[model samples]
Target chain A: MADEKIKSPKIQATEQMKQLITEYYIDAKTTKLPEGSHKPICWITSGGPVEFLIAADVIPIYPENHGAMCGAARIAPGLAEVAEKMGFSRDLCSYARADIGGALTESGAIPGGLPKPDFLLCCNNICGTVVKWYEELARIFDVPMFLFDTPFIHVEKPEHATEYVRQQCLELVKFLEERTGSGFSLERFAEVAMLSVEAVDLWKGVLATAESRPSPFTCFDAFIHMAPIVTLRGTQKVVDYYKLLKKEMEDRVAQGVGAVHDEKYRLIWDNIPIWYEMRNLGNLFAENRACLVADTYTTAWAVDIRIEDPLTSMADAYTKVYLNISIDIMLEQLVELMERYEADGLVMHSNRSCKPYSLGQYDLSRAVAERTGKPSLIIEADMTDSRVYSEAQTRERVEAFIESL
Target chain B: MPVAGVDIGSLTAKAVVLQGREVLSTSLTQTGHNSRVAGRRALDMALDRMGLDEGSLGFIVATGYGRTAADFAGERITEITCHARGANRTHPEARTVIDLGGQDSKAIAIDERGKVLDFVMNDKCSAGTGRFLEVMASALEVELDDLGSLSLESTSPASISSVCTVFAESEVVSRVAEGAPKVDIIAGIHQAIASRIYAMAARIPTNEALIITGGVARNIGVVRALEQKFDTRIVVPEMPQHMGALGAAIIAGEHHE
Candidate 1:
């Protein structure tokens, strides 16, 4: 028994996606005017309107993604320490701390730091912290900063809210045009919007394949492969990549091959992942023959986007994101996900870095338990900072939850 | 067939042997630095007392923080599930369990069949745990066993605002410097732990039939404080620390089927 081997089946597409992301970064890093480059680089939030930026031929960069890389490399806390020493509150979001620390220190997991942003994009749809986080970057860099404010959705999407967000989408185009010294092209935007829509649809298809009994791929695989959808969503490459991923998942489902060797209980995860402990968590659940089939975090990439009237739809889509809604809406979504996936339980990550996501999880967990008659486990930890994690405590909670199931 | 259960906790290792529904023997020892050594020693002691060898046992189960480290048991289960099972086997009507171990505290809600329905645990901290009491005992220059009774003598317990063990120690030092009565300070520490546990326990749908288990349950001061805070009578088992091992043995007996 001691010699028994436990192996989590590797997703075949990750190796190719890793190479693809590396090349994409190298291209963004090496781009310069010396080589007759005219594309402007803009540092955007993860939930920013990247399709419009892509349509205007501007390169978009997500610092939050870089923060995840720093976490994986285990340099996030050291980098956050730099920012904290500079008087930034340790209570600030770790992603914000890591990004601010990386900017000031000009060093990170990637050599020479991220390419200097020609402009900045801020969206409050994800969290209010980004408003201050981006303001600091703008203060230091002295660049044009655009703020897209999407009010929280409480009961329903009011007409005034949609109108307000639609106006900002138009103003956003004008802001980008003025900064880049170019005019917005309707034809170009139509192509990019359609590609973005197709990419999102493919991503939805990829996640839906997990509804199979022994999921073809776990959410851990989705967390890694989700980069292209976040970074390259409005491009043809993203559409092509997801098509390949969806086909592979289809084959796995047909072959009855699961992410874990023996899949017993299927669980749905809420909130962002513990990036530093992904492999550890994956192995932990896999060892118990429990597969995390779906999660709320990665589903943000597939928010309903209408291509017919892309700008107006963008207004509603970006405003109604999971984090920007009320607990009632979140509970509704949780119930839908639970039924759709037939999950045995839910695991809520009470992330220290994300207040908006973690604030109402207790209520949400209770609601989920009542609605689905399934257990939900709340494990406290930070997404990027390993310092907040207690392995022994988390292990006991997870083991007991699995044993009860 | 006789079955054995071993619980290797952070601070103690306990073993229990059962023949049918009767507990044949039980043993407890400090876990020391090596949990596997402590586990073997405790289990051997219990088996020796019962005049039984390893070959006589039908199955063995392990539980607690050091459970996986033992590597000798046929199966491992978490203390949360085991505590509920063990409490149910003894009380038969226990719907809730509050377990305050050496390093962590948890509240488990169980159904009629001893199946865990819901639960909540303290954030990874020593607050509201046995370790917290030990630190306060040393800081106040009192014995760990005497802390409970000392607190009982105080009419006005000095207020302890800090729930963190480290901060609470410094607070105790400052109080001692201010010449506050030692009995009052000890009572305050128990109140703080009881309040913390009560708040965590409130998260689950608790019932009147509640059982408090683990090594800390032997502290009457904590039990009294919890009774005051929760306004409910608390039940303490005869061998509180052995519940996890006893539950595991109960499970081992069932494994034969």
Candidate 2:
């Protein structure tokens, strides 16, 4: 530390972001209501990872989902700047920066800023970052962090990995039991799983509504609407909220209330939302009546694959998502979303923030576009950093491609 | 009689207020916080530079990601339409246009008069886009203005493989650790950027006078690197960043009865 001139990028938003996150912490901490046991909370990776958590009398909060929202809100830039100011390289994903920055800044201060986690769980099937992120979080909070180590079995649904994940879910129950002084009940767990499954089924129906010719709702809306699910997924309140959303979407479809007016060409989107750009892009699509019928990111919450339902069913599904698997699974999901949405084209954002999501997307674009006789538009941009967006270039490409489609 | 164009790009908003064939004013400004505010401010600056106001214009067309958001705009044209229009106006023989903007990159193959034929765009990553260039340029402590020139000083350019911006930051750290020449690494960054653009250009047999537009056109190093990659001198229009907006304005002019 002897006069080392740090060659870090100039992070202009660092102090302000730290202040904002600290504010969120203060807001979340100062207002504490009477603790309710049934309102038990758990945070996990995806819509699936929380199933066991939900089934175990715990409300599920998806930190990764929240992380994406922070990126989308364009707040991640400031947080990343803060992280950089702390000597972390700009090389880490902004999500990691924002999360760590916000947590460090809060130090027990905002409404839900680093909420005291009763328990944390992950399938670790998605990214190597999950383990490190959770481990670090667990270390800081002194909370129980359960890791479901699923083997990297590309396609084969091997039993060992499933068993490993299942054991982790049991461990999660034990971990929760230690805090609440309650034992695991198999019957109660199954009931909770069925309820979780039912909630997801309704969510899938809502997503399916996008397939309508006019597209009742855009993926942008879905991204916001999915917030309740992430914050309260295991709760009956979440299930009730989605039921209402699904019915409204149904009514829209029946009455022909399209999210986009004069729906002409429907398209499917692959990869993450341009977080800071969903509104502009959504409006652009609406201008042309080209509904973004489905998105890979939003659709994940609605994934209801036919997996065996027992103690381990939810665990396996949670860990076996496209984020955790190879490109083949992603490609398959693309095709499925395309066909289900009845899209005339596909728009793939080759996002710079996440490589695993963007990997081989070109091939997926080509294959899906040519094989299905649907055109594809691939636009490149960062998820959070506005510096990465070329508004003119993107508009040009999107307009040209969409006009053709 | 004069026609003007404005390209309200993500990184910077540029205004090219042309009085007939004579260029009256060209203004460039950072998009800062709000694109709407930036677009309006850029137009006002350009108009002020020309000793005119918004009402003095025959018509106005807005283009770019912020085009639809332009309230003063009488009409909105897609960046594709504007880029080609701007390029064709600058170089009549131009058949292809590549616009590397702040967040994304695109290649448009156009006809003689600036109608798009086949096009490819990369919208997913920051690798080849302005953000990537800015990040790498910052790491090298080379001003955006000097990156292109610095690369020229390189004897042998190194390679950058990470398409993700975050990954590339680490990659740059490794390059520095290996003691690679800063100039060559800078040159390699330009090449990494060029390769991403070239992939889009290769989607079809791009026509001659391959005009490069958008904010990236300001990067002389990227322009030079692209020229080398394609084995041809790439065409860059005067006030290249404003091409999209100018194309929009031109379209607006044409649409006026």
Candidate 3:
């Protein structure tokens, strides 16, 4: 297996990205609060308006990303079991279970477990689970929580909905000011929002490079590379990091270096990645000479944010993200992804953690296949929970899907 | 060239040897504790039946859940594709294949060339599979093979509403304790399994030439129940259990080319 990995080279960017994330996490954890100009830590949802936190000079931490780390480390089930033991339903979102468990047990992939949150930011743009999940956290930590209620976009985002979210953004800034004793800075906010947009555009450019025949990188690479973009979105480090990563991808494309050795087929992935099975899943496709060129999960960050009008644009962008929208729009997006990536098939992970992403995937699978004249495979598993995964069954389905293609 | 296909399923291992387009020999055996041993035993039995040795075989392909566990095969294909290929081989017009194995059930949609177009499988449930039938047979104190013919004798099929196998088993036991006829309860169990299978199969368009191929296909009651629910005449190939191995053999022959 070690030799196999050496033979199949991983993206050169992953090593650097890991160091960057490590440094970022260390800085967030070690930074002192209320002393020597230290920033407070704000536990934010994955799809929350983190730029506001960044603009307010508050260190933002994502429980979802931490849950994914625990998943990759194969400790999610232990954490989830902790939550289940506390009377939470096993059917509840695994990420929430893991997060709640990590908080309670004070055990996680990280050493100290997500730098004790000074406050909580709950956003429902990604899923409704976060609202309740964060409320529970607020109760446990006894901190002032800010909830950004982004209305679901069934078909279209109404102007009032945008105004509603925009006003909430303003309120969030005021909340941050009152809690941290730091006034909002428009100049710093604009700079952070611009950097965030630049990082997102760079991420988009990196993903688009996969449109080349024998894609330069796979979705697994994007899944890992997406870390800095998610956690440090509004920081200059994210922009610099993505610039360096984008250059590597461009070079690989120019050199005709595909992520898969032979690249016999190109496929698109749907829903959150099965975090525990990332390497196994990557190898499964790579072994079949089928490269997963793109996925709907990581591309959520690529939704171009308008820095000129950051408030309203952030509201619209976050509201219309891939998960918060209707099945019609989701299917359309899947169809477009298939065509754009020139995928031979689409592999949809019927993820158990993320219902907003997993629900309606079967219907979307058929719709995309009909549109692309290709095939689609739906594998049932949770994003973070490894116990729900049946390796033998999933292997059979994946191999069969590739064989059919 | 004599090519072989091996299907190492959860309960049984099957093998088929093909010389060109003609099936030279076939073998079936209990999978037992080790899939690798079962696979080797099945293949060796087929070879011995053909008055040949392993050296005579040109290529081999493995299918079923234990396909990866077997180290002997040159390639491993999925049972979904194998079933489709085997069904299409036996019945030239077969476009759909429903395979009911010990622990799982699947409905596969295939093209004219025997390539799988779409498929759906039961989600880690034994509610609508051969294992479910075996459990019901034991609960009714009936032989697995005889349960099907016995169910045909019932005039009124009892209602078994529980979709879960465990609950359905308890339902069957309770009905028996209540002095309900075994044949009616058996019929209901068959119908319950068929309903779940039909629901999963309905996910994709079940085009013409729907064929049922698996160990459970031998159970006439479940087959008839499924036929009744699908509202279509289902064809069961001769030696349905060997279809996956046969398909693997066919694929092996192609790979040898």
Candidates ranked by TM-score: 1, 3, 2
Q: Please identify model 2 stretches exceeding 4 Å from their true place.
A: A1-41, A68-82, A107-112, A170-180, A305-308, A373-375, A378-405, B1-73, B85-95, B99-106, B111-228, B232-257
TM-score of each: 0.98, 0.69, 0.97
Candidate 2 C-alpha lDDT tens digits along B64-162: 777767787777667877888888888889888888888778788788878876677675566788888888878877787788788889889988876
Interface RMSD of 2: 4.0
Q: Name the weakest run of 10 consecutive residues (lDDT summed) in model 1 chain A.
A: A1-10
What do the candidate models score in CA lDDT, each in turn?
A: 0.91, 0.72, 0.89
- Tens digits of lDDT, candidate 3, B49-99: 979998899999999988888888899899989998988899889988999
Off by over 4 Å in 1: A1-6, A34-38
Residue B216, candidate 3: how far off, in angstroms?
Answer: 0.5
TM-score of chain B of 1: 0.98
If candidate 1 were superposed on the true structure by all CA atoms, what would the RMSD be? 1.4
Across the candidates, what are chain A's individual TM-scores?
0.98, 0.84, 0.97
Clashes of 1: 0
Query: Every model's DockQ, to 2 decimals?
Result: 0.87, 0.23, 0.80
Models sorted by DockQ, best on top: 1, 3, 2
Best prediction by DockQ: 1
lDDT of 2 by residue, A1-405 (tens): 111121112223234334433443344344344773344555566534565555555645556555666767667777667768978766555566677776666521123465556667765666666777777667766777777776665887778878887787677777777755667777776665666667778888888887777777777777767665544454565566667778878888798877666678888877778878877787667666577788888766664534346566666677676687767777787887788777888888887767777878877877786568776787878777566677656766777787555
What value of lDDT does candidate 3 attain over all alpha carbons? 0.89
